[model samples]
Target: MQRNQIIRTRLGWTLLDGVERLVSALWPARFKGSVGRVLLLPAVLLIGILVIGLGYMIEYSFHELDLSTYRLKDEYSLVNYAVIADRPVYMRVLNRTLLAALIVSVTTVFLAFPYAYMLVRTRSALTRKFLLIALFLPFFIGQVVRAYGWLIILGKQGLINSLLEGLGLPTLNLIYNYPSVIFGLIQYMLPFAILLIVPAVAAISEDVELASEGLGANWISTFRYIVLPLARPGLIGAFVVVFTLTLTDFAMPEILGGGTTDFIASAIYDSFFQLSNAGLGAALSMILVMIGSVIVAAIFYLAGTGTLGVREQSR
Candidate 1:
């Protein structure tokens, strides 16, 4: 029995060795460091698709749409871009989008920081769990659903108005305005800002804050000096994300702005679908992309590459 067992073990070892040799032969030393590259293949493919789509858009932008035939002109020109430059409505929409983006980014960050700080610094497990639930609950709900929910709550004959009527107060006009759009955007973006900031806040050492307190620094002082500087990367990241998203937002402006406070996205939609002007829409899209890229580049330049986790080497 022992001899039979020993023979079986030797056979197993031989099979394993052969399998290893086969794997090594199939995957040579030159390809050993390619696992990460393999993992990145899907992302590269996605980016390639995006680039191809952008190329089509660029081509479309160069051609004028024939209103009579509802087709693009054979010749390429800058007539679509020229219309945007000459039209005041396009510039107005662009300006509104930019302003909304700035407001939403700043407001979201300000509101999110305190919530994130509490979530990270709380000693009670229940409080932490509650905070996490509140933060993530909105994420599961679709943005359109939430936007509609706001319409229900803030509509002229909605809950708030009903309550005001009960109390003999005038019903306020809450929805379908620029403020309402900004309000909805801030609500939608708050969770994202908190999520980005929490990691940065958690990375801060409790001992550092305690030491600052021991050295006679007040809580406000410690927070302002220590926490703010350390958590800047997350703040900048959240700001960039919120700003870009708000800048290109379609739903909030469409649903809440009620066509009166049209953003650039609304104009783009009208150009493509409502007006059947693909060339104009493509030009607007390219402009939006350029504006977003420039703003993001400016942020990286002003805030440094640290926001992207690339630290500068010491001199």
Candidate 2:
């Protein structure tokens, strides 16, 4: 009986020891995590600053204003929002903004993808270096300068028209419309998309290509199935970059859109500068903020849920 008691006691001690070890592992003896010192803290601070700015804008958007004093009036009113809601012109401008964003984004990706592919796949070192430098060259120049360069190229009687006329062909009017805005936007945003996609294309394994070849797959088939799937993150990233830039870009649309092709940004500028309507301008800015918020939220949700894998499967 004494021996039985000792064995039971030893087993109980062993069980208790294991429980203690597990508890220690799960909840450490020392709490080492500094929540304030997390890597995301700086990002949180930056986001907080932006949120505060947006909050102030939202607050300003809700009030009436006295243009003489340049101060807000008492009593919150929805008059600004009502003005936007009643105006078909505002809605048209919003639609134009979305359409231009879509066009520029799609064009940028389509053009950049092949160029980036060649940059990575080509074996020529000088060619690769030159392409990279050329891609980044526009960024070194200011946006205003680049826009002016496009103005020179696409303006009435510009180089393209001159060339066509020299060839005895009728001159085409490409500027002062949607096409000019899209052209300038693509030129401005292409670098971002190319940079985002090139790394993914470069990172593709040679062994994977070889394996696909061994399976009787041709180059096209291999690229379609094996390569695209692996590079999906980069592609998605590029699309997001292009889409967001085109959606928010003010310079291209302002300079190239002319009066008839007024977008939300141009509308906001007109309200502020021409009309001197700060409240109205704030309201328009708020509207853009809401639209941008929706887009960003949708992108985040799609990225979080991994629904962006459609890019590879569609191919």
Best by lDDT: 1
lDDT of 1 at 27: 89
For every model shown, the clashing-pair count is 0, 0
Q: Whole-model lDDT for model 2 versus the true structure? A: 0.83
Clashing pairs in 1: none
Candidate 2 lDDT tens digits, 209-309: 99999999999999899888777667777887788777777888777776768878888888788887777888999998788778867876776644334
Model 1 misplaced stretches (Cα beyond 4 Å): 1-30, 312-315
Candidate 1 local lDDT, 129-248, one digit each (tens): 999999999999999999999999999899999999999999999988999999999999999999999988888889989999999999999989988988898999999999999999
In model 1, state the lDDT of residue 11.
Answer: 100
lDDT of each: 0.93, 0.83
Give all candidate RMSDs, comma-separated. 4.0, 12.2
